[model samples]
Target: MSYELRDHTADVAVEATGDTLAALFAAVADGLTAASAESVPATGGDRFDVEVTAESREALLFDYLDRLIYERDVRLVLPADHRCAVVEPNEAAREGDSADPDAWRLAAGARGVPLDAVAAREIKAVTYSEMALERRGDGWYAYVVFDV
Candidate 1:
């Protein structure tokens, strides 16, 4: 999983690439953290856990990213490394109302440093404009815009 900062007209953008859906999610989450700060601890920090559900993959990506922002803002944590797992419908899932909650869910955990303790940028919010999450060929790609 990897990410690169791309130029956005006004906001900050990141292009994430990975071989699997889980990697893509992690990369994008890492990208969001990268855009906000620099030189995070390689490992071993406070644990950050987030679970989000969305009807579609695109929305899932959006929510996942937005949640990262929320976590950073509220908890003052910046992700240094993360792992994501998608519980398939064919596999075991946490009990919830199907009609009320979205079908696809992501359970992710991250380890990051405190934002206040690091040199960080203020990311205002995540935007839907120019947002993309899709697979091409053998790889997955995600593009997200952040209002900085």
Candidate 2:
């Protein structure tokens, strides 16, 4: 997985690519951390398990980033590592079995970094207006814009 950061007119833009959705999400999280210059401690002293559901991959991407923003702002959780996956609902199964509340699960490995070490301003939200997720050959790629 890989990520590239670009300067946007208002907010920062991030693009990530990977062989799988899970890898791509993880890379995106890493990209966000890199952009913020948030130092993730080496200890597994703090962490959070996050789950988000959305109707489409694009929506999932937005929700995934938004969750990260929330974690950073509300919980002071600096992402150290992340694991995410996309699960499609089974339409033919029973109602309860068919619908998974977490179409995506993001397990974030985090540890509190010194407040002074965190150099970037907080990210407010992730926007869908310019979001893009698509298949590229045998892998996948995505582009997203965030509101600072």
Candidate 3:
């Protein structure tokens, strides 16, 4: 997993690339966390699970990041580590499956922290107005604009 930070016209931009979509998402999360804290130790003892569906890969990526931002703002949960599984649907509807319209499933967990301890510039929210996620060669890449 790997990611890089670049300057954006409006918000901070993050680009992540990985062998798999799940790995790419995990790297994105780690990058976001690093923007605020000096370092995120792999010692989160808490767990969180979330399922979100969108109309496109870009939307799905935005939703995934938004969920993490929600946890930061509402629950004060900052994830230092993440695990994701992309659920592929078959011709027949799968049980416990909702119409995602998109092509991914992003369920993950992270360690929790106090809201007061979170940095103010880490990320305010995940903006959908200008977000993108695309396939590149054998891996996946994503661009997220955070409200800083």
Candidate 4:
């Protein structure tokens, strides 16, 4: 899995690729962290868990990133070292028989340090504008833009 930050017109965009859906999400999460900070320490920080769910995979990604931004703001930390897993929808859910709004779920574990520990940039929000997620040749690729 890997991720890279690209220059957008005025905002910031991230492109990520992974061998699996879970890895794809994790790489994107890592990209978000990198976009939020110029440098983060390798060790000694607080750890946290985030769980987010949505009706669709794209929505799940949006909410997941938004939640991380929320966490950063609320906890005053710069997140890093992300580990993420995606739970696919069950057959019933996919068939629209399940009423759960959280049919698509993402569980993530991450580490973060106080914002003072790094040179931080303020990311206003994650946007659907120009967002793209797709499967390509046995791997997954994602593109996300952030309003800085």
Q: List the candidates' TM-scores in order.
A: 0.87, 0.80, 0.80, 0.91
lDDT of 4 by residue, 42-148 (tens): 98778999998788889999999999899999998877898888877784366674567348877898897888888899999999999999999999999999999
lDDT tens string, model 3, 23-141? 88888877777765665545534677777665555666778878888877777667567777655444114645546433555567666655455554667776765566778999988
Best by lDDT: 4
| Local distance difference test, each candidate | 0.82, 0.70, 0.69, 0.88
Per-residue lDDT of model 2, residues 23-125, tens digit only: 8888787788777774555554455677777766777777878877877777665555666665544431333544554353334444444444556667777
Q: Write the per-residue lDDT of candidate 1 for residues 27-91, one digit (tens) a residue.
A: 98889888888677665568878998787778888888888878877777776687898654433
Candidate 1's C-alpha lDDT? 0.82
RMSD of 1: 2.7
True-structure lDDT of candidate 3: 0.69
Residue ranges of candidate 1 with Cα displaced over 4 Å: 88-102
After superposing all C-alphas onto the true structure, candidate 2 shows an RMSD in angstroms of: 3.2
Residue 59 CA displacement from its true place in model 2, Å: 0.9
